[model samples]
Target: MSLVVSPSKVFRVAEVILEGGIAFAPTDTIYGLLANALDRRAVERLFAIRRPSGRPFLLLIPQEDWIEELGLIIGPRQRKLLSLGITLVIPKRTSVPLYLTRGRKSLAVRLPSSTAGFIRDLLKVVGVPLVAPSANPEGLKPATSVKEGMAYFGRRVNIYVDAGKIVGKPSTIVRLIGYRSVRLVREGNVPFREVLRFLSS
Candidate 1:
């Protein structure tokens, strides 16, 4: 069953995950069901919930600076492209499971401006990266509330943090093509205009 919780409850949710369960959580954008990225069983359960064949999930991290740990950061031009607020999928050399990577030899990673500190601390304590995607089925609009998350996953998830409403848009997604160039993959909260301004300067 789903229960609305508070930031203080993050510790409780972390406890549940330590026991090998999953959680539907609130982020800046939408609700996401998160699991230990390296846990095979957890990953399987996540895929089972979505029931997708090949769609890949994005890995949320606490900081963008950590990109070096996974893969090389794109060059200035690519970084400029990312400044446009697009999500970038890049190659990584991490211990994250191949399944989590979807056998793609890379991972889509992002450091959300919201909840980054909280999630980062939690992951540090858990000793693993958290894998999170929109808490909805493939091709469906993402859920923005605890109620919506529960309605989507029901008892499949262990807990839901009711942090109130979320921004309706998904995160902007871009992929690094080279050191100085990046491709816009998906546009969401981070506007392309703002991104261009940031990268240009």
Candidate 2:
């Protein structure tokens, strides 16, 4: 019972999201369930699907440049490096809820490179940052298609946006240790060498 979708139908999907429904949608790396990051109900639904807790979900922004406005506690050095397409997980002091931050002072934030414009515009309409992790349970293979996302989430998610398969693996993850130091959390599409070059310079 998979539904095939097109780019023209993004607005339809957005409407569903506005009504407080979760969606399985395509990304540059894989299919991810998108919901209003600020909504506790939506986040609860996401956690129910993945049975995940203790670990915080990553927030994906549409534009790398928008990180400044969205993040209240990013350092100047971290902001500068992030503008170059580096994924930065930095500490934040905000009322964004401890559930989203996993009771930690830090938050994992990134601007997806490939779907920057489309995702950014979608978020603008939704009026919330998107909390998107892999569309699968923790420690499992990330879904690369709508079918995979459905398989993992089943009827937990309200809708599906099928846009074919993803091009590659997951996005790279790096945590800002100090002003200029970043630790590799997970190596995926972005190589470690490239990340090093960005932080070094």
* Best model number under TM-score: 2
Runs off by more than 4 Å, candidate 1: 1-3, 71-73, 76-86, 93-96, 114-127
Q: Worst 10-residue stretch by lDDT in candidate 2?
A: 63-72
What TM-score, over all chains together, does every model reach?
A: 0.82, 0.85
lDDT of model 1 at position 68 = 63
Q: What local lDDT score does residue 126 receive in model 1, on the 0 to 100 scale? A: 67
Candidate 2 TM-score versus the reference: 0.85
Best by lDDT: 2
